[model samples]
Target: MRIPRGLLAFGLLATLSATAFSSEPQWVEVRSPNFSVVTDAGEKRGRDVALHFEQMRSVFGTLMTKANVNLSVPLQIVAFRNTKEMRQFAPLWKGKPTEVAGLFQGGQDRSFIMLDMSIDNPWSVVFHEYAHQLMNGNLEVRTDPWFEEGFAEYFASIEVDNKEARIGKIPDVTYQVLQQSGMMRVADLFRVQQYSKTYNESGDHRNTFYAESSLVVHYLYDNLLLPKLAVYFDLYLNQKKAVEQATQQAFGMSPEQFDKVLRNYLSSGRFKYYPIPTPPAVVPAQFTVTAMPLADAKAVLADIHLHSPDYQEKALAELQEVLLMQPGNAAALRGMGYLYLQRQDLDHAAEYFRQASEHDSKDPRVHYYNALLLNRGSDIAGTDRMAAMKKECEAAIALDPNLADAYALLGFAQVSSREPEKGLEAMKKAVELSPRNEGYQFNLANSYMMNRNMDEAAKIFRELARSNNPEIAARANSELAQAEGYQLAAEGAPEAGSQLAGPSDAQSARASNQGVSVEENGPAPAPVPSSAPVHFVKGKVLAVDCSASPKAVLSILAAGRTRKMYVENSARVIVIGADRFSCDWKNVGVAVNYRDRSDGGGDVVSVELQ
Candidate 1:
């Protein structure tokens, strides 16, 4: 049934009026939207999400579409940075409450797609949700367990993205009604009480909800249901036409006729597949980027012709090859440095950035990014490395005087070097180029405060305080108050005298140790305090002792905990530090792949829960 006219009208008007699905999300002047986005990360995640989706699409297309079901539908996905993000979207769910990730509303033009990036197969959940979205976009008819869920489960049965991959057929829910009660054909079970169901109404079957629906969908796919699906889509979604009319229009038959075929396929209980005799080839464990040959080296360099989307890894890899072939190939060395920096592979990134600087003394991107990678965050490589990186950034900037990124990189370097003045100048220059960049604006304010330029700092802080971003704005307000107090003291009546009375701005700044804004540091949490720990963990898995096998780790299955700390990853090591461990461990890298140790979920991969 349609939503109450009043409610439908109200919901549509409300959602449509709220910011019209941002045209250029990246360019939007994000004032501190909600949570602070991590900086230098340009809508770029450390791992490839879009690639994963494409790989999924490619694999699914190869397997499912070739056999039958043609479920191709264009979809716009909203990938969240993490679960912490919810203020950005309104829930668009129908039926019972959905979990962290799913399609909230399929009926509307812009539906909610929340994928918890923290999960390993976030794409898998996205794949399941897309089935709903696709069905809504294509068929336009509302469906129940036998259709909606069955299709989702069917689509989820595609190959996983691993060298040695396996796919198993399983239902989303256990104890399905068809297997247990043997009542109601999948055809009728799929149809909703056309007049009563809507997004707000909640009703769903526990068993047969997911699994049976999936099996039914698989039947349709195997039995050539794509054309029928297309027909449904054309009739209903395309024209908002009625079901019987759409069925007649697409299949040249009434809806009742299609229902008959659906029954025959489902009841047969036989599935179709060209079974894999052996698992897919698993590549060796050794990690190495493939290299281009000597002849291909020149072609590779030619490939990196500035500003090309198809810039191949070969172009960069070839540079390495060329350097190896002739150690002093300045062009190749410089190219290698450029490519290394491009990938942000800092040590190699630095080597190439250095070569470019040495050969040309002016390439901006090389020096700028090198400085950034070398210094940013924990300084994994150390401060001396950062200084060298920043120095290169400065040289790159000096050579051109208009390198915006170089300025940005230089600003970070200056901050790390305790030279807020130089940092302030660079940050300002960067802002001039990209005025809306949050990181630049943020650093500029910090630089101002460091130089005791509180008035200017407060101005920027006040501006950012009203942004859509919560983290930066919160920090801005707190900083604004500090700046205001500094202003009051600057007017006289304080121990710190004004620099204006003594000498030039630079001289006075140097004398007073000006621009030294810093947060106070306190004691760190000690490991010994684990004694007073409020939460004690159970069923701890010990890392393998003296074992060469990387996967020889013990599985720690504690009761009442979904969060599993990985012994292979850094989690358990830090939590249970080296000092407290009684168990002898092997050469690290041991991870319990699955927590439950069950095979029911059909080739689902699980890492240690935590």
Candidate 2:
């Protein structure tokens, strides 16, 4: 049976203390690029992680000053080289090799936080854990998963740049990916109460809890209901009142009523991804190879004017022709494989990857894709191909050690191959290599949890839950809440900082809407427009896809008239409608937009293509 909730990891750490702590605790150096300790695995990475941490601290300092909010906690985030090694610190299960990173365990009053980094947006993860730090370290209150986890997931999604942090919103990607596919309605997706039982009785619907919490946070923050929400938080923290009480007081309605409104809001959109709708009534997207020579195929890929199950069919068909023209066209083979993978047609993907590998022996993508294909198989070949898959994955890594994707794939292969420890180690390397990608961290956490290494599992979950990007945090907190004693530790992180691009950089970030916003006073250069396309930066409103409702809705931002992606929906307005607004954009609502289908060629710019 699984370990009981509320208490499990403490015993191991307590035991370790009894055996070894005769002196005051000095931070043990892990594999970070920032600081180093005179211990094992304390060479280069410690300093790297420290450098990254310090950078994030500086960024946070500026943001707080700008946002005009004071935190009661000193948030500390850790950057791990990889997932497996992060988990190694926890009490290794029988024969296990690692512990969890990004957990909030062992520290007094839960002052310690840990996280594993493997993404471009490290701040998202940092903010999530930082939220927890504020609750425990500063507030000095008994935080609940329902509130703390939800808030962390909500904040990490808030992105900031050009000295301005964006606030609450959902990711357009969430809408895009599910828009034409099988996705739930916003009401079911955004309802906060879904997380009430993340770790209730007989397990939890982890993903649903996270998605729902993010949606709920989106509705509240989008509608500017946080101050009111705070009142509920106050009551919940002070009297340990149930969410039911908090909800009634906070919204002046029962949870069911609130859920209904949210559901209506989401369903009204008319776009969703899920249950594979009967073949789109119209012709789906198709890539075509209209012309071909002995060594090349004329390939033209069109944007799916509207999403369809066969969105990439034309592209895949063209890729097949390219393979036929030059049986050894590695590029063509690789393209076909990836396309199939996206469609989740593992068999076809494997077929393409296999040929791609044979044609380009040194291409890491080939090996990585091949391994992915092998793993995707649902038959005996898959069950028996572990050794082969590991070899391919290792080969991919060997070709390019910094290929974070390879590291992640290898970790899974290793674990599946029964060398769980080695697999875990590979996962650590994966996180380190890509310290800014979510997929790797997600897989790493899964490995630990599945292996019954709760400490390690819980740690990664904490990092994810406390991310600065809502998507990342939402997913993380949901899983963490379900994991036993996950709130015990958390890793600290620092912002990666930005390299100024142009006048439109801030605008671009707004379009993509990726991370959280913070307060600062520095006069960042006015973002000048360049070839770079705008992206929604989580907190602020930016671009709208051309495919959205064909209304005269202007894309959000400071510009517009031509239905541009960077158009503003409305000026940033603080709740209570006061001047010099300190819009605490700790809640990024969503990420969406389409890019110009032409040059800087195809830099995404549409929330709904015009």
Candidate 3:
């Protein structure tokens, strides 16, 4: 399982105690082509940690038939020399640290994998989490919980040596667990969602669910039925077919039939594993090992604490100590700046970030932090502030070209500064760097909207509306409604355009401004047309007189008075919440936007059914 940062409060170091830092071990950093491992378990262990990740990454790329496998966010691996050290970072359960060999903690900007080197096989836990990262990075579509967890479990058992790597080997514990707990029905297992009680609360049912899920995946892999899963998912999700029906169509088996097949396969006592030659590029001997300074190592740990919730005070204390020892430490300064930024102390954050930049101007993260601080404090109408933020973002990008967040911020700043084309380009670059990042994708959609590409923006919004993340889905739905309105307005529907343009125009301006300015300044005022003013009324349609074939006049009860509204062409008049305007309509609830006439009547622009 991927632990979300700050969700668990391991209160092991609630105070700034000397015991926590008195016996600080020697920390070494191992750098490979694609990963970094920081460990106090000697350089050899650190190198091994980095090599294992490289091997797994290689395997993932090979399996996905891609040359490179990207982790959307940066990852730092922390290996402890013993379980006692590892327990300090473990999740607390019943007021004590949960016993675990390894764990993965995820964050927006960075992720961490913690390991206990004393364990005989800590690889499985970390590998399982690493597989999830790989899946998130590689897969565009969200899949069922069963497939995701089962695939991770299967991939977790991977064993890589110097010459070869083995995959698809089932762990013996899975079989033992299933045998003792019995298995869930195939249909029941398939119906399990991420939030289902069976998947969330751990017990016999959960264990059985996982065991059966892994078994199903193993069977599918062995039978070469994995490729057909797309058909199954499409039929079930998009086509809205029943699970049994979709499974039958895709795998030539009903739920009951699959259940029997799985049980038979499990009882057959035959399991297959695949062995592939290890990629020559993963040469552990080629990796560089460097001794990390004590303060720097502590600073890294402090940064982890900063990311984890309920540890801010501890993180702050640690950073202060590190700075006290070495005030010019750039990493420590950056950590302090970020901690302050998280607390919304913009002034202090700026000060620390400035000092960090002065010490090490080449640090991309420091530049990015400074840019973030500037963006957070910027005035929406101040073009100079936006330009400064953009410059900082550009500097960060120059230092580290793959910094996606910097590009994202630059895009927002550029668009707000009225440089829509440049903003769109920067947003696209951010998405290109981190394709799986939904936030970047959202910004990219907004950029498209600023460029007046409503159709493309709406397309992205529609997809995002189905996201598993509620916040993203809610925002996407809101934007999608506005985008649809804009689409209708763009299609020469003047009445609809006038009615919908009010909120959307303001929202578009604020969208470019992003979160900072909008929160500070609220939304920009809606633009009004210099032509005839539009008036709105909501009431019941009393009657419609259509003595003229094409033209009609409706008597509406609004504001406790009867008013007549004229439609020059009833058939052509804009009608919302329905297919077309009705000539003989009566007693229907409606909202109308119109232009006032000289005779105390009104010329109807658009009518919306309520």
Could you give the C-alpha RMSD of every candidate to the true structure, in order shown?
28.3, 29.6, 14.4
Looking at model 3, report the run of 10 residues with the lowest lDDT sum.
Answer: 513-522
Candidate 3's TM-score: 0.76
Q: Positional deviation of 212 in candidate 1, in angstroms?
A: 50
Per-residue lDDT value at 209 in model 2: 54
lDDT of each: 0.46, 0.46, 0.78
**Can you write out model 3's per-residue Cα lDDT over 308-383, one digit (the tens) per residue?**
7746788899999999999999999999888887766767889999999999999888888877766555332245
Q: State which candidate has the highest TM-score.
A: 3
Number of the candidate with higher lDDT, 1 or 3: 3
lDDT of 3: 0.78
Q: Best candidate per lDDT, number?
A: 3
Which portions of model 2 show Cα errors greater than 4 Å?
A: 1-314, 378-383, 446-456, 467-610
Task: Determine the backbone clash count of candidate 1.
Answer: 21
